[model samples]
Target: MQKIDIRTVDVIQYLQPLREGGSLPAIVKADDGFLYVLKFRGAGQGKMALIAEFMGGELARAIGLKVPELVFMNLDESFSKTQPDEEIQDLLKFSVGLNLGLHFLSSAITFDPLVTTVDGLTASKIVLLDSLISNIDRTDKNTNLLYWNKELWVIDNGASFYFHHNWPNWTEHLTRTFPLIKDHVLLKKADQLTEAAVEIKRLLTEDIIRDIVSSIPEDWLQSESETMSPADMKAAYMEYMTTKLSNIDLLVKEAADAR
Candidate 1:
């Protein structure tokens, strides 16, 4: 299992609002003098989005994928006063505590699968990772990829862990099959799904799976039910991921069948 240490930084300046998805992440300059795509804790999607971003990015990194460095960005209430947009002001005011940040890739262009061709091994690995995490946002409509400095970087995985949204019966859906992967943009290019499956199984060991879920901040694991504490939620996330590891073959076959 690989270890990850999350870096924290103070958001010194709000450069601009991204306003893309429901979360409405913003581009900001941190005290470290780097621009970051900051995902607010007060967004409609709540802290679950941040959990998905951190957990998904870390998993991608562990499997040798290109993902921007993630940081815990601190935003002060005073910072909201500087924004003229009333809506953004309210968002910042509510997200005054801790937020998740993705290192911004300046001038990076959105990847178009039709225009660019990816290698078989890399494509297969990416498909496998998305399946393992149950990421639903990597379809052709939204690639969630950026081409920076001649490399394809994966980004925006807040929609990966949908299971967290319905925690009450999460266990019943643990073995649920992901049939939507047929729409994955890279499915056609991933000719080595079988080989990728072996690699994914080797990389995502039980200990590695637990370590990944444990890295999530306890504060983000807000309980939706009285019986579910933050620690219990974290444990559930671990169990969910580790259990999903055994079902990768189903996902691979689904993608292969789609191809």
Candidate 2:
């Protein structure tokens, strides 16, 4: 896999608020004249959520999953003053610097597995990728799958890589199996867990892993704890993910059992 680059885009307009999730991500128009579902760093989740969005979404796209383009959105402080809603204003105020943006799919509809038939191999790949990242947002209740341009597009991976929230104990959780596979929307649809595992392992090379980890902004990695600098935190993430990749067999087995 080639090294992936994270682009930085400036927000030109804040169109409207997407009231779907607790974080209150908004559909904002960027300078590129593209609409993006912007996940604010100032919202309830903070910088950890943005890191997960950057890392998890990239990993999904890296392994052949159809994820929208992920970019670093620049939000200016003045933009928040135009909003009348106190909640949104506070969110923008808090997220005045860098935020995560998901390229908005205008004509896409939510993917409901009951009405659509996803191939076994594709389903298995999605499940395996989600498991590797420990994503908890892709359940039936809110299947993050979007049917757009006649293909399924993965979105909103902010809930993944939750270990970053507790960096001190990230090592302990590195080898743990993702227990949420049982309720995964695609568990029954997937039958090629082993094949998917092989493909994932092959695609996630060491250089690719490093690029993903370093793709995160330096500001996001800042810690009040003097023990772990931003560079150390970045190394920690790379180490943790590479360890998880080696131990993916356990997760594959867990997914198979759930199926």
Candidate 3:
């Protein structure tokens, strides 16, 4: 499998904190002269959330979905020294290493399901993607979707693959039906789930899965396992995803039934 290439940038400035979620992700300017929304490794679920975000975003892009460009953002301890708020300073102090960043969509608007009309195929594909990744945050209350340039963009996938939080028996979740599909924001419009399944299976090949899983930073996997090395963790992720892909039909049926 060809290795995936993700760019790494150093954060030069902390712009502001986006206080919407518990994670307290912030907008920061990187050395590359661009602004990005940085997900801190020190916050909420820590590096595991970044791992899930990377996997979810890359998988979505592999299947022809619009996701903001993901980058490895390096944070320095000095950035925290002059911070006014104790909470923000403490967050930066702890996150003084590699964190995940997404390219900022300057004029993007939050997707409001009440006013937005998504087509059947698009909605079905989104539903399938969420089901495969086991993302539970895309409800009407916290739709993580954005509208930019008249197109839908997926964002904040840190909530995907939540099984990693309790890593003892992660395999048991591979073929389990995603009951949370009933709460997905797009479930009502997902009429072309069968078609979406076929397309996802075609696009999200083993090579793609391997490439994405391999791209996960070793630091993120370090504290997650005591017996398993980072390499072992990567292999486990590959296995989980491949098993999930093979059982896509079960996910499709569950999603269709939920609607």
Candidate 4:
């Protein structure tokens, strides 16, 4: 089994807020002297969003897609107290523990499907990955994709795997065809679904899924359920993903039919 480990960095300074999203993620300088887009744990959608972001980004990387590096960011209580803005300070105060961050892409531009064209294989892989993870944010209006360094980079996966929000019936979602995949921004360009499936299956194995689920911090899973422990939450995620992998053909068919 391949062990997946995420680097932990202490946030040194909160630069500014990226106000586009509801979470109010900020660009912060980490102890490593690098700037990262930090996702607050206390934001709307809570730590579940961070877990989704972490798992989704790592899975995208595993499937040969370009994703910004993800790291575990530590936000100190004292650091939150120094912020001048009331709203920002409140957000930081609630997010004092561990949060998630992505490496800041210097000059990345939002991917405009109308202006920029993507190849069939790349589009198919992205579509399939999004469908597998149940990501609803990658639509025409909000393509959570970036064009940087002459390549397409995936980002902001906080909306994936939403079944966790209603844990009582997570299994019901495992077999879903994800009909919303029709709205995927890359659906029209994804003509190579079969080829993408073959490659993705080869790369994403059961062991890899297990490693990704295990990497989620226990603190994030604590508030999920009183009856279900963190370990139980991890197990649920593992089951959800493994079941989704086994039923990948359902998602592929859905995408193909949508196209």
Best by lDDT: 4
Q: Between prediction 1 and prediction 3, which has the larger TM-score?
A: 3
lDDT of 2 by residue, 1-259 (tens): 4789778999999999989888999999999999999999898879988988888888888888999999899999999788899989999999999898999999899999889778888899999888988899899999989998888888888899888887778788877888998999999998999999999998888888898887889998875753678998888888878888998899889999998
Candidate 4 versus the native: TM-score?
A: 0.97
Q: Native-vs-model 4 lDDT?
A: 0.92
TM per prediction:
0.96, 0.97, 0.97, 0.97
- In candidate 4, what are the lDDT values of residues 1-259, reduced to their tens digit? 5567799999998899999978899999999999999999989999999999999999999999999999999999986778888988899999999999999999999999999889999999999999999999999999999999889999999999999988888888977878999999999999999999999999999889988998999899997245778898899999988888888898899999999
Q: Estimate every model's Cα lDDT from 0 to 1.
A: 0.87, 0.89, 0.92, 0.92
Candidate 1 global Cα RMSD: 1.4
Q: How displaced is residue 155 in candidate 1, in Å?
A: 0.3
List clashing residue pairs in candidate 4.
Answer: none
For candidate 3, write residues 43-148 as lDDT tens digits: 9789989999999999999988999999999999998999999999999999999999999999999998888788888899999999889999999999999999
lDDT agreement of model 3 with the native: 0.92
- Give lDDT for model 1: 0.87
TM-score of 2: 0.97
Off by over 4 Å in 2: 225-227
Clashing pairs in 1: none
